[model samples]
Target: MRLTVNGSILLTELPLLERPAAVRAAGFDAIELWWPFASSTPDQADVDALVQALADAGVQLTGLNFNAGDMPGGDRGLVSWPERESDFLANLDVVTQIGERTGCRAFNALYGNRQPDADPVAQDSLGARNLAAAAAAVARIDGIVLVEPVSGMDAYPLKTAADTVAVIDRVASEHGATNLGLLLDVYHLAVNGDDVDAAIAAYRYRVAHVQIADAPGRDQPGTGDLPIERWLGDLASGGYAGWVGLEYKPAMPASQTDPFAWVPRERRTAH
Candidate 1:
């Protein structure tokens, strides 16, 4: 399959060592990783070992996820914290360098929005400014910047696809930038009350990458509410030639984690 599955095993109770075997055992061409560089500096050998893991496991590093600033002593989001905005900028530089080293082409900088107590307009201005800075920084690298949409009903506050699009546009317009883009998360968009086809149709040319988690439970392909194959066909048809990222958590053991087990053989293309 041309799709990429992330070792989001970090978020789960799974041991990090097992993530690679799980990804390989499931037959994915690439694996996604959260931004190890941005979270903190790591030893070069440790970073090298990760690169080697991808090689030994035979999976490419497809994307790195990097979230922006959140407030200390509070739930303040990207738009609120001006104090540690340095961390956000520093993270971008780190991600760009990592992309150069590891061949990851895109990174997700999707930060949350606003403290419940903050004023809305002020938050927008803060987010837009930070995004503008982020756009300028990422444009210096070969890799692209990806912002995700979150759903308010879900748990995180900034879940709307429309909100993310607006933020990217505002940043790009403000900075006269070209590299800012979107990580279209199909499952989250659905959860936030968006139609996949409509969002895909609107943002086809603007998409830097796409990640797919089946809806309802965010599990393997056959168990969700999404019309997985047909929409994937539509994505390929719409000129989104990038890999379809499998970002779901498997409900079963890694042995049972063939994500495409439900995919009909005829529909799955040989990579």
Candidate 2:
């Protein structure tokens, strides 16, 4: 079980270009990132600079997200949003190109919040179509498309591991592409009252990526009541040998104290 820091979470206070080095300085060689630029389709210079940052820092980008609109402003994702479907499609090439450059094989695609005025059937159909398209696009690079069940957002349909897997299955079946997988986030599962053990037992084979954050306050591992180690151990025991992303909110600034106290320094590296 290798560990990878989620740059979006760990380096939230720094500029996008500065995050790769910060992650490396924190003793992690592999990191995951959300779409770093505000625009899904950013200029080539911005892309080159981000690639260069990771190269200069000696950190590998293990995973990346397709642009989920305004992460801090509560926009869950654009792929499934009817109004933003085109934007999501347009971003496929951009994200895939970045993935190719960064050696990121896993790409998370969030299901958008349900629209109140739109017909539910239409929304579901559109989401399926877009997800199928996404699956095909990333398959060109032998990348896996991840579908995650997010918690705390009432409007989002996927709130359980089962829900996420169902979508993964749908995309795989619809597109005949086996590159679709589930991104099991322990925080979201625990927060939504789902049985983490049962989820791993049922879906471990389909999991391509795993994210961790303690439940309740969504804080670092030891800061909350969840059995973070046991869960991680369970994931390993269940045959998940992939990178586990640290997607938690650090309790304090990194300069004051190490945010990864729960994980020993030596265990943090992918090597």
Candidate 3:
């Protein structure tokens, strides 16, 4: 399996435009991002700078997320939020254009937290409608839209591989878009007490991308109880030949100990 880094996680202290170069300097040729723009509709110059940054750094953008509202403030995503639907729609074209420029084929659309007044049925219906639109938008570029199950966020309905796959199926059936897939983040599954091995065995075919972070502390692999090597072996045996994204928090700053010690230097580059 090929290895890629998540710039949002790896280089947290750097400027948005400079993170790609830091990822490249760390020996990874492929990286992913979580809507680096401050506003959903950033100026063209910002977009040009981002595209140029990736090109100048010589890194491939493996995956990206459509704007999730205030990720640091605990918001999951805007697509499914009834109040922010316009914001999600506004950012759709920007995301696809970024994908077009960066060769990123996998896009993650997070399910927002449940609202107090909205019923479950209404939330799901709206989520389906928004996800269908996102699926169609990215399908024009041969991109696959990902629906992920996040852990620890109870208000977010999708918290298991099965839950995420059900949404994926719903969108595919309702919109006739087969390009939708699941983004299996091992950290979330492990935190939620799901069997990672079983998940890979059952959902390998539907998985478009895989992200990893050790549980308990959500830090690098060795800082927690997860058997990283064994899980990776299972994924390999299950025929998941896609990028394994390093989405862990560094124990220290990038200037300190190497955050990627678990991944060998030779395996850091995309094969």
Candidate 4:
């Protein structure tokens, strides 16, 4: 039942550079993030500053997203987009560097939305290629590549655990990629009408990382109708001994005190 704060989503009131320290101060020794840089290949100094910030905050970088490209603009990911294949490939170097520097092994590569103009079969083919490359790169550090079923965007194709697992299987079969795995995001799966219990039972061994938020609002645990604690217990029963990323919008804004009051303070840190 180890927990880690999602620095990218949790401490939105602080500047990006300052969120790591805030996560640490809030009592989490480990943090995960979206791609922290605006550019796929940011200046080397910016990369160093991020590494230094984590080191100074005494928070371990447990997970990170590869450049997903304009998340605010509705671009789910670059991996499945034919036009952005080069961008996705170029970003892998930076991902590998960050993994090497921070000892972060799990990397989530979002499967992009389906394109109206492109062939779905072709997009799937290209996604497998791109994912294979990412898998090979991260394997250098003994890391695994994560593909998640995302929700909230209709065009985003991967909306169920089955959808993501299909892609994972394709990448493994076609490319012999053993390092690719599933990122079980409970919020997305629940919101998309997938059976969470079935997914946990079926793909528990394939799960590389897990994230949680209450669905219907994507907010903190108690604010919505999800039995998050029970699901966590189920995951433990299913033999999942990995970091559970707290990735929801705080019901109370980060400007206020104690957004994490829902979690017992002693349970906030990884065991």
Candidate of highest lDDT: 4
Candidates 1 and 3: which is better by TM-score?
3
Clashing pairs in 2: none
Clashing pairs in 4: none
True-structure lDDT of candidate 1: 0.66
TM-score of each: 0.82, 0.97, 0.96, 0.98
Task: Put down candidate 4 lDDT per residue, 220-271, tens digits, no spaces.
Answer: 8888888888888888998999999999986666566577888888998885
Query: For candidate 3, lDDT tens digit of each residue in 1-271?
Result: 8888898878878888898898888889999988787777889899999999999999999999999998888889987789888999888899899999989989999989988888888888889888988888888789988899998788888888999999889877887878888898999988888788888888888888888898788898888998877888887887879998899988788788878777788998875
Instruction: Please give the CA lDDT of all the candidate structures.
Output: 0.66, 0.87, 0.87, 0.91
Q: List, residue by residue over 1-271, the lDDT tens digit for candidate 2.
A: 9999998888778888888898888788998988888887999999999999999999999999999999788899987789998899999999999988888888999989888888777877788888888888888889988899999889989989998888777766776767888899999999988888899889988889999999778888878898989988888888889999999987677778777777888998988
Clashes of each: 2, 0, 0, 0
Lowest summed lDDT across 10 adjacent residues in model 1 is found at 70-79
Give the higher-TM-score candidate: 1 or 4: 4
TM-score of 2: 0.97
